[model samples]
Target: MADALLIIDMQTGLYDGPEKPFERERVLATLNLLIQRARHAGAPIFYARHTGPAGSPIEAGSPLWQLWHELEVDESRDHLFNKTRPSCFLGTNLEQQLRAAQVKDLVIAGMKTQFCIDTTCRVAVELGFSVVLPEDGHTCMDTPALKAEAIIEHHNATLAGAFVKRTCAAEVRF
Candidate 1:
């Protein structure tokens, strides 16, 4: 089965806001490496952008809605999906796109470790695709209940080998 890299919601709004999470640079670096690796391996790279309603922080045309500049998005080579919900498949054509590409496996990486990342991972698994999550490829803001690092670690530990198989950016193989 063919595999594609699914980069979820790595938009400017999530990383540049007041409640920014630590280790963002590290996550971006890992994502960049994964992009390069996916390209070199001839795997399709797909990006998901979250578009909030009008007046919302992530509203369309807002700087926060754009993908981080560190990862260059080549429209010709990559597929971009704009989502209004947490799960990329909820109201979007992600499933159609993946099916069109004949993709059977997905390598997911992106923001809000427990929300968008976790939701998409579960949905992807339910959709019958093999899900691969790079341990350090996703992050979230610190909450009163848990630190950002703890949230990330908890998700990685819990999701690994269950909802998704946890792998590091360097260990991912096409």
Candidate 2:
């Protein structure tokens, strides 16, 4: 299966709050490394930015909707798709872009572990694409009741080896 990298919602909005996500620094370091590795290997890289409705923090065309400054974005080299919902495949050109790139295996990593990352991973598998999830690549903020680490672990436990294969950051070859 040909592989592609889908980096979803690593936007300013996700990082601009009082509470930061668990393992955020690690997520950024690992995700950034994966991006570089993917580019070096000539794999198709897709950046999925969330486009919230009007009045939302990440509203379409808003500054918060933009990718963080640290993310390496080259419009001429990578594909960018705006998603209206949590799942990247819903109401976006993601599938078409994947098909055009002849991508059959997806390596996904991004924000809000139980939302976009989870939804997209399951949907991709259901849609017949192989999925690979780097264990340290995604994260979310902690709620008042639950810790971010626990939420991340819970999702990882639920998704890994079932909906997707869990691998480490440096171990991901493509």
Candidate 3:
């Protein structure tokens, strides 16, 4: 089955503020490597950008809604999906795009360990696509009760066996 890499909600708004989400440099580095590998393997790349209502940081026309500069998104080869919700498949044409690309397996990498990343992984699996999660490729904001590293570790450990096939960036295969 053909595979596509779904990069979910890796926008500036989530990582450019005074208090950013997770390890910006590490996550970006891992994602950059994933992008290179996926591109070389001929795997389709899809980006999901989160948008919110007016006045929100993630407002459609706001700079925060844009993907981080490091991504260097290539319009020619990458598919872009703008979404208002956490799950990329919710209220978006992501399903259609995947179907059109004949993608049966989804390799996910992006932001918010408890939000967009987790939601998309669950939804993709429920939608019958084999899901691959690069362990070091996703991150989240720190909560009052937990640190960012703890949250990421918790999710990776718990979600590894059931929700998705969790592996390191280097282990991700098409």
Give the alpha carbon lDDT tens digit for every residue of 44-114 in model 1: 99999999999998998888899878776778879997999889899998999999988988999988898
Tens-place lDDT digits, model 2, residues 73-112: 7789899889888899998878888988888889999898
**lDDT of all predictions:** 0.88, 0.87, 0.86
TM-score of 2: 0.95
Candidate with the greatest lDDT versus the true structure: 1
Worst 10-residue lDDT window for candidate 2 reads 15-24
What is the Cα-based lDDT of residue 157 in candidate 1? Answer: 94
Clashes of each: 1, 0, 0
Name model 1 segments beyond 4 Å from true.
none
TM-score of 3: 0.95
The runs of at least 3 residues in candidate 3 whose Cα sits more than 4 Å from the true structure, single-residue gaps closed, are none
Error of 3 at 76 (Å): 2.1
Task: Using lDDT as the measure, name the better of candidate 1 and candidate 2.
Answer: 1
What TM-score does model 1 achieve against the real structure? Answer: 0.95
Rank candidates by lDDT, best first. 1, 2, 3
lDDT minimum window of 10 residues, candidate 3: 1-10
